[model samples]
Target: MPKAKETVLEIDLKALEHNYHFLKSKLKPNTKFLAVVKAFAYGSDSATVAKKLQDLDVDYFAVAYVNEGVVLRDSGITKPILVLHPQPVNFKTLIERCLEPSLYNAKILKEFIAVADAENQTNYPVHIKFNTGLNRLGFWESDTDYISEHLKATKAVKAISVFSHLAASEDLTEIDFTKTQIKNFTAIADDLSSKLGHTLWRHLCNTSGVLNYPEAHFDMVRCGIGLYGFGNAPEYNTELKPIATLKSVISQIHKIEPEESVGYNRAYTSNGYEKTATIPIGHADGISRQFGLEKGAVFIQGKSAPIIGNVCMDMIMVNVTGIDCTEGDEVIVFNANHTASEFASTANTISYEILTAISQRVKRTFLH
Candidate 1:
């Protein structure tokens, strides 16, 4: 194995297992769990996370695209994989790989039904997504009749589950809106179940939903961020262990004088003589530009070193004054000690963006 060097993303499989079990415990008995591993398992390595979840006996895996499902299949994951935003073009490959698609709209439903029929597939599971409130994807409440009619007409396609996404399940301030969404989804699910005359698996909760809305657990729950640690709620933070940490080594150290400029465009000027350390991580490695010029920081010698000046493509300068840091010193950008959520908040973004936007070029080291 390559030794730890410049920038590395440390993945904690043990924490992943812990989060998985924590979320699983919140679900209703006999209810299934779908591990959402899309976007490279939220940019931490999908194959590794999926394999771990599979070993943990997760009932299903969900991805946002067919290619993501393909990744799981290639990794020898035998569990059912749900493609949330599958396009018609990948229908053939999806069937060949035994990957199920989430048919959201009439167009997708009709196209997938035709493809299934042509492929001689029977009871090939596909999910139906309803637009309860997110308004991002899924069929509208009014589109239910058309969807039902098409499903009835297509004998080849099988309705595996009916699901919706929560718009603001994490925001307690939006509890009313979240309740409205739940009500809408429940109404739509009831209508669809009655019309189909057969019960299909129902789910509408993400990690936040699993935590906040146990009454709406339905038949299954899809978990993404919760599995990676941050539960979108402050109370659950202590229960869930973060699965990934961004660490880098100090590449160089420099002495700065009072009134001296640092980094690009003189974004930061030293207040006095100070020691600065340059770390081998930057926007190219997923540290956003917004983190530059005092917005972001790294932990060194158990002390916080505020980032100085603009973040470069491959390097970030930190004011390491009064610190004993030297070249090759390990610096933590974000970890269980310094949560990614804090960095994200500094950047005016969410932890999901921070995790998912991590560049693929960085080295990943898995730890148990």
Candidate 2:
């Protein structure tokens, strides 16, 4: 893509395709690939990302809510979509949209069964989540009897899959804990299968688990960050390509004398005569305030320009001393090479937070 004339988040479809195939290479031939497109496909355009993945033939998609699934359906995403944290109020719409639900607890299970039965549905597919280690949402192994009994009593729903999340699959220091979680998930799936009188497919691996725990790559693997070109670890990141590159133009340049201040609250006072570039993105555009006062930087003409001042609601000032750049020059907030993860670290955050925090108001330019 050409250099940005204005602030834009360039979504590279080719890079996304590469990341998908790279992640797919880690799985067996039959292992299903589920792309997590929640949070607007990690703050890019969800419909565009999902549509591109759909063309690449991803086996499934997962979202956090019912309306996200509805968007996918409306975008002509026909693949099976799993609503990972569906609320009871949207259960009716969820069913109507043919989106599967992850029935994690007894309350959700009972509630969904009532709704599905009331809709006069038959053998509606549902995922049973086991709380192996990620205690966020899921049922206990001991609840298998309850789940089995509840499932047997109702023809309204059927167990399509059983899965769990890894709390720290990216951290090798937590290998033992992750292995235990995987073992627990396996055992729970087994007990649930026996009680349900049938064996259902299971998925227990997240992005890191897919790379680090091939043994636990059950029936399917769900990847979100990896699909967006982050592998959760430096080793794996080297193998994937980042898909989003945030670029903006240097709207203006100013000469600052010693003791002169920049940005809101007079946050940055110049120590020496310096040149500063004003960027159009600010906290409202997802660049955090914590990045101000020289904590973060933007690359100008291959040189690093440290952000100097309190990040404003709609702008940031970067020290551009000795740079050959001028107004209208492209400024890279984050790019595939420089990386959002690296940029986020300047603010003591993660790529997920930065990626998903990108406001929708920013224009998105897709690259094939």
- State the lDDT of candidate 2 residue by residue for 159-269, as single tens digits: 989999999999999999999998888889899999999989999898999999999998999999999999988898999999999999999999989999887788889
The TM-scores, one per candidate, come to 0.97, 0.99
lDDT of 1 by residue, 33-146 (tens): 999999999999999999999999999999989999998899999999999999899999999999989988878888999999999988888899999888899999888788
Error of 1 at 28 (Å): 1.9
* Top candidate, metric TM-score: 2
Candidate 1 pairs with clashing backbones: none
The total number of steric clashes, by the backbone 3 Å criterion, in model 2 comes to: 0
**By summed lDDT, which 10 consecutive residues of candidate 1 come out lowest?**
1-10
Cα lDDT, model 2, residue 328? 97
lDDT of each: 0.91, 0.94
